[model samples]
Target: MDTFVWRDDYSVGYTPIDEQHQELFKRINAFGNALWEGQGKELLAAHLRFLADYVVSHFQTEEGLMTTHKFPLYEVHKPVHDAFVQEVSSVLNRIADAGLDTATAILVFEKSCDWTRAHVRGMDQELGRFLGAQRNSTAA
Candidate 1:
């Protein structure tokens, strides 16, 4: 029901991660728009699958960067990614079973978008700060 828009406050201050986050938002918003338009079930499913694949790929990149940087909260942060994967899987299953009704699909899509925004703002932002501090400390 509520339209999601990217805002300056969402940036985590790390360029790569911020870019990925933006892409994620863009993809999710596209999916949401398709649903809002009362698209056909097949089209909705395709968009949902695209979003799921993108999330997995992006999460891998983010996780790998955190591991390489030895982010202090990596352990805590990774479960968020894992949970997202599981949630997406569950939604896919529901769509398969119930055939992607517009209202239900829109609700699930919004939930996915909310989770991503929260994770980026909370966990990713903290990781960005940690990484930035580590880089600055090493430089000095």
Candidate 2:
């Protein structure tokens, strides 16, 4: 599997969010490397646990920012975060049930990372635009 790389286009125009996304990319890439080297079975569960926790924290940060700024679509955007948390929680549950299998590792990465990539480009970018405009407007 190719390492997940952060591209310039993924920038949400927010430093905190962008930095967090880069950290996510690093974690995913690390997991991918461990999986490809056949060490995933031992570390997959731990890696996933850490990833899940970090994701929740990151989501909370985004939500808090949106709420603080009074982002118009915060209500709509929050559910996406809720859904993603549920999805990742389910994956964690599966790992707890069946243990770390290569198939699960591969599948999880493809789905989770793909969703994250699309999210940055979609909803997050929109949020970025709003927040950036808010900052600029207030600065003037």
lDDT digits (tens) for residues 20-130 of candidate 1: 888888888888888878888888888888988999999899889898988878899899789879988888987875567787787778788778778888998898888
Q: State, as a TM-score between 0 and 1, how close model 1 is to the true structure.
A: 0.91
Stretches of candidate 1 above 4 Å error?
none
Q: How does each model score on TM-score?
A: 0.91, 0.94
Worst 10 residues of 2 by lDDT: 33-42
Backbone collision count in every prediction? 0, 0
Tens digits of per-residue lDDT for model 2 on 1-140?
55788899999998999999888888877777777887756588777878888899999999999999999999999999999999989888877856679988999888878999999999999999999999999999
| Candidate 2 whole-model C-alpha lDDT, 0 to 1 | 0.87
Q: How does candidate 1 score on lDDT?
A: 0.84
